[model samples]
Target: MMTIKNSPASQPMLSMTGFAATESRFTGGLLLIELRAVNHRYLELNVKIDDNLRQFEAQVRELLQSRLGRGKVECRINLKSDAAVANLTLNPEMVGQIAQTLAALQQHFPQAQPVNLVEVLKLPGVCQTESIDTEAMAQSLLNGLSQAIDELIAARQREGEKLKQVLLDRLQGVREQISIVKPLLPALISQYQDKLTTKLREAMQAEDDRVRQEIVLYAQRIDVDEELARLNAHIVEMDRILTAGGTMGKKLDFLMQEMNREANTLGSKSVAIETTQVSMQLKVLIEQMREQIQNIE
Candidate 1:
């Protein structure tokens, strides 16, 4: 089981896709497996095989589905050489065709290579012979395919690791912005209160009591304390999932959206410039994570 801690890039990147395969052989046995994959909305697969190997399609599909979660994949199997030929094959049809053609050419060019049985047999399609041991080929292909599939999985895991690091870095950035905005909250509330008081003083020059009541009601309606608390809670959930490991892509994606929602709400409340900046930074980090989650399996 490969994990996200193995990529070299150390960043959240969602564009990687890879493929690999291998094979092995045994007595009267042949197997070739090819694996292909790419990022997509969900895990999808298509398995293709030569007409003779149609029986193996289900087996290959099951093998892939059990291990992968979120990519479009294709698998194919075929015999690289004809097994029916056994040790030697001769094409009578080709021999006849070539012999006649060569005789016609000799009429015009006397010096042309004379028609010869050995030469005709050596030509393409004239003789199909092999020392190929089908058992050995099959076993070798099965072993090769197993290795290739493992290679493909490794490639995907390496890419996933990079994505995880990138997300962590972005999360740290969001935390820093949150810290910058956190201390400003008390001062921000006081400043808004002061501005309200000033406005009330000018508007109610004739009557001060009426203006004070309006200012208090305005402050309560615009409060963003609840939104900030939820934002913090979402961040905790994200960290927990990352640390626990395993298939958490879908869960992480949902949490990212929730984080963005909180940020949006905080921004709309608009208590101060620092808070607004923090909200924007949170959204940016969430967006980056969302893109990378699509590639996780």
Candidate 2:
């Protein structure tokens, strides 16, 4: 039967970067497994192993692909033999063949130096090292890898929780800035209307229909009601996405872009210094959230 490790049930948000390592010792050698991951748009597995364990590379790749959905992941394996336990075994068939060939050569040319046992043993394929059970070793290495992956996931989850809190705090900051600007809009518009009315009375010395039309047109041009409405809607959508959490990085990123656009429009249309400051604050908060979102998975 094959054993497999399962991830935690309540999957919190995950960050794309983490590190973990595990080591195991057996009678023949020691095995060390290390896993490192960083943010990436898609899953990319890079496995490195000693030449002796090259045969296990495919299994390692399959295991990583199954466990991870997104990231640039690198898996490194190191195996070391215990000097006290290491031993060499001769291949009888190979040694016999080499001996026969050497004998034939000696008969043909008696002056040829007779090959000693040590030199024959040193020849290629003549001596075989004490062998490890490949299947058993592979299984042990896989088990160690599974443990390392589990640790990596836990680390990412912890970091992700921190990210979530930071995002929520920034979201609240955005809401507060919106609140500060909302009440100022109506008063700002009223002040502008009063000023225009007084200017027309002083300059024209009579109530003119054209002046009224000009005031209305100027008010419309500076109105930011549409931008404010869109900003509120984007904020609501972002809250929903964050609450419903699962691979929300891209969605949150798009929502940030929308929010920034609205803020820019609001700033451009602002007739009051208070409104301009609020717009700047909103943009700064959105930018901070965006920077954190890039690390989220």
lDDT (Cα atoms) of all candidates against the true structure: 0.70, 0.85
Candidate 2 achieves a global lDDT of 0.85
TM-score of 2: 0.82
Off by over 4 Å in 2: 1-10, 89-127, 206-212
Q: Which residue pairs in candidate 2 have backbone atoms (N, alpha carbon, C) closer than 3 angstroms, thus clashing?
A: none
lDDT of each residue in 1-297, candidate 1, tens digit only: 867675443323233377776654444445666788887768788877776455555656666777676778887776555456445678888877876877788888998765667766677787766555644654465455567667877887777778778878888887786677667766766787677778767876635466556656766656776877887788788877776656677788788888888888878877667777777887887888888777776
**lDDT tens per residue, model 2, 129-206:** 777777778878888888999999988888888999999999999989988987886687778778887887898764
After superposing all C-alphas onto the true structure, candidate 1 shows an RMSD in angstroms of 7.8
Please report how far candidate 1 places residue 181 from its true position, in Å: 2.5
Q: What TM-score would every model get versus the actual structure? A: 0.71, 0.82
Q: Specify the highest-lDDT model's number.
A: 2
Q: Once superposed on the true structure, which residue ranges of model 1 sit more than 4 Å away at CA?
A: 1-16, 23-33, 82-86, 90-142, 206-212
